[model samples]
Target chain A: MSTLIDILLLSLMGITALAAVRMKSLFGAVMLTGIFSLLSALWFLILDAVDVSFTEAAVGAGISTVLMLGTLSLTKSEEKTSNHSQIIPLFVVFVTGGVLIYGTLDMPDFADPLAPIHTHVAPHYIEKSGAEIGVPNIVTSVLASYRGFDTLGEVTVIFTAGVGVLLLLGIGRRREDGDE
Target chain B: MTHHFILRVITKLLIPLILLFALYVQFHGDFGPGGGFQAGVIIAAALVLYALVFGLNTASAVIKEWVLLVLIPLGVLIYAGVGVASLLLGGNYLDYNVLAHDPVHGQHLGILLVELGVGMTVAAVLTTIFFAFAGRGHRDANGNLLPHSALSDEIRNRKDGQP
Candidate 1:
C-alpha cells in the first residue's frame, strides 16, 4: 500500500519538475519548484523520516519560495531565450544520472536487515542514545549531543551565509542613515 | 498591500499564529520532528509574510534592521560560548556531559542552548537577506527611493476612488 503511494508521489514530483523546467515565466517556475519541494516533503514523510520532511516543508517550500519570488521581482519575470544548444548539457545529465543509478545497484535492498548501514554504528547509537542523552528523540540526541560540533559548524556556516548575503546586497551598514 | 482590506485582515490574524507556531517548534524540537534550523526558517517565513502584506518599512519598524545585525553574531557567540563554558569546566569542546551535576541534565541544557543559538542565527540571517532583496530597486513616482512595491499599490488604490 505504501509502495503505491510512494509511486504516485514520485510520479507527481516528476511532473512538477518537468513543468518547472518547461515554464518560460520565472514566477511559474518558482511556484512549481515550491510544489516540487512540497511533494518531496511528502515523499520523505512516507519514508518515515519525519524530521527531514519537516525541514523540507519549512525551508524548501516556505523560505525558498519567498526568496525566489523576491529574486524574480528584482529581475525579469520571463526567462530570456538562449541561442546556445542544450544538447551537450542534456547528454551530460543523462550520463551522470545513468552512472548514479548504476552505482546504486551495488547497494543492499531497501530495509534489508543485513545492510551495512544497519550493521554499522547506527545500532550502537540507537541502543545507547536513550541511556546516555536521556532524550525521547534520538535524532535530537544524535544531532545536538553526539554531533554537537557538526551542528555548531552548520550554524556557523549559516551565519557566514547571512553575512555574505548582507555583504552582497549592500546592507552591511550599522546605522539607519544609508540608502535602502 | 494596505489597500487590500482582506489581505491585511487575514495577515494580521495569521501572523501571531505563525510566530507562536515557530516558538513551539523551536522549544519542542528535542521531543519532536523540528529543531533550530526548521524553526528558524519558519519564523523567518512568518516575518517575510508580514513584510509582503504590510510593506517592508512597517516590518522593519517592528524589527529594526540593527537588531537583526546584532542578533546574527550574538547567536554564534552564544553557541561558541557554550563550548567555551564546557571547556572551562574541564570538559572537551562542546562536551555537555560535564555541564551539570548529572550528564543527562547537562546534555539537555547544552542542547537547548545550542539549538537556541542556531535558531537565532538562522532567523536573523534569513530576515536580513529578505530585507536586502526587497529593499533594493525601490523607487518613487519620480524615480526616487520609496517603499518598493507598496507605493504602486497605494497609487492603484488612489486610482480606484478610495481614500
Candidate 2:
C-alpha cells in the first residue's frame, strides 16, 4: 500500500512539474508552480523529513507563490513563445537530472538507522543536546547553538531581502501618491 | 462593501483565537514544532484575512504604515541588541550563555528576546508586502483597470463606451 502511494505521489509530482513549466499563461504557470511546491512538501512529509517539509510548505508554497504573484502583477500574464527554441534548457535539465539520479544511487537506504549520518555527529548531538542546550528539539539546539552562525546568516539573508523589497518599493512615500 | 452577517460573526469568533494561537506558538517553541517564524506568519496571515474581509484601508488604519516601518527596524535592533548584550557580558557575539548569571537562564532569556525580534520583523514585513500588492490596480471583470480614473481621461473615455 505504501509503495503504491509513493508511486502515485511521485507520478503526480512529475505531472505537476511538467504542467508548471509548460503552461503558456504565466499566471497559470505560477499557480501550478505553487501546487508543485505543495506536492513536494507532501512528499517530504511522507519521507519523514518533517522540519524540511514545514520549511518547504511555508517558504516554497507560501512565500514563493506570493512573490511570484507580486511579480506577475507588475508584468504581463501571458507568455509569448516565439521562434526561439528550448533546446539548451532541455539539455541542461536532462544533464542535471541525470547527475542527480546517478548521485542518489550511492545513498543509504531510506530510514536506515545504520546510515552514516545517523551513526556520526547526529548520534552525539541527539544524545548530548538535551544536556548541553536543555532544549527538547535537537534540530533547534543545533540551529540556534551548535551551528549558530549559520542560522544567524539565514536570518541576515531574510533581513536583507526585506530591505531589498523596501528599497525597491521606496519607503518614505505617502499612500496618497499610490506608491505605497 | 458592507459587512455580511456570517463574516462579521466569524471574524469576531476566529480573530481572537488566531491571535491566541500565534502567541502560544511563539512561546511554545522550546517544546514543540512551532517557532517565531511560524508564529509571525500565522499572525500576519490572520491580519491578511481580516483585511480581505474588512478592506485594505480599514486594516491599514488599524496597523498604520508608520508603525510597521518602525517595527521592521525595531525587530532587527532587538535581535542585534541581544548579541551586543552577550558581548558586553564577556562573551563572543550572540553567546546567549552570558546573558544571565546562570548560563542556562541566560540562554533562555536570550532565546526569548531573539524570538520576539524574529516574530516582530516577520509579521511587519509580510503585512507590508501584502499591502503593496493588494493596493495595485488590475483588470476588472470588464477587462479594464478597476480604478479607471487613474488612467488619462482621454484613455478612459476611449475605453468606456466600447465595453
Question: For each candidate, what TM-score against the reference?
Answer: 0.90, 0.82
Instruction: Report how far residue B67 has shifted in candidate 2, in Å.
Output: 1.7
i-RMS for every candidate:
4.4, 5.8
Candidate 2 local accuracy as lDDT? 0.74
Question: lDDT per residue, candidate 2, A1-180, as tens digits?
Answer: 988888899899899888887889999998888888898889988987665676567666766677677778778899888777779988999999999999999999977889998887888898987776777766666766677667666666666777777666544353232223
Highest TM-score, which number? 1
The DockQ of each candidate is 0.44, 0.24
Q: Which regions of candidate 1 fall more than 4 Å away from where they truly are?
A: A172-180, B139-163
lDDT of model 1 at position A85? 94
Candidate 1 lDDT, tens digit per residue, A82-139?
Answer: 8899999999999999999999999899768899988888998899998898887888
> On residues B1-163, what C-alpha lDDT tens digit does candidate 2 reach at each position?
3649799779868988988988887787767766667777777777877776776667777887778888877877888888888899899998888888787777777777887887888888887777656654432323222343544563465467554
Docking class of 1: acceptable
List of clashing residue pairs for candidate 1: none
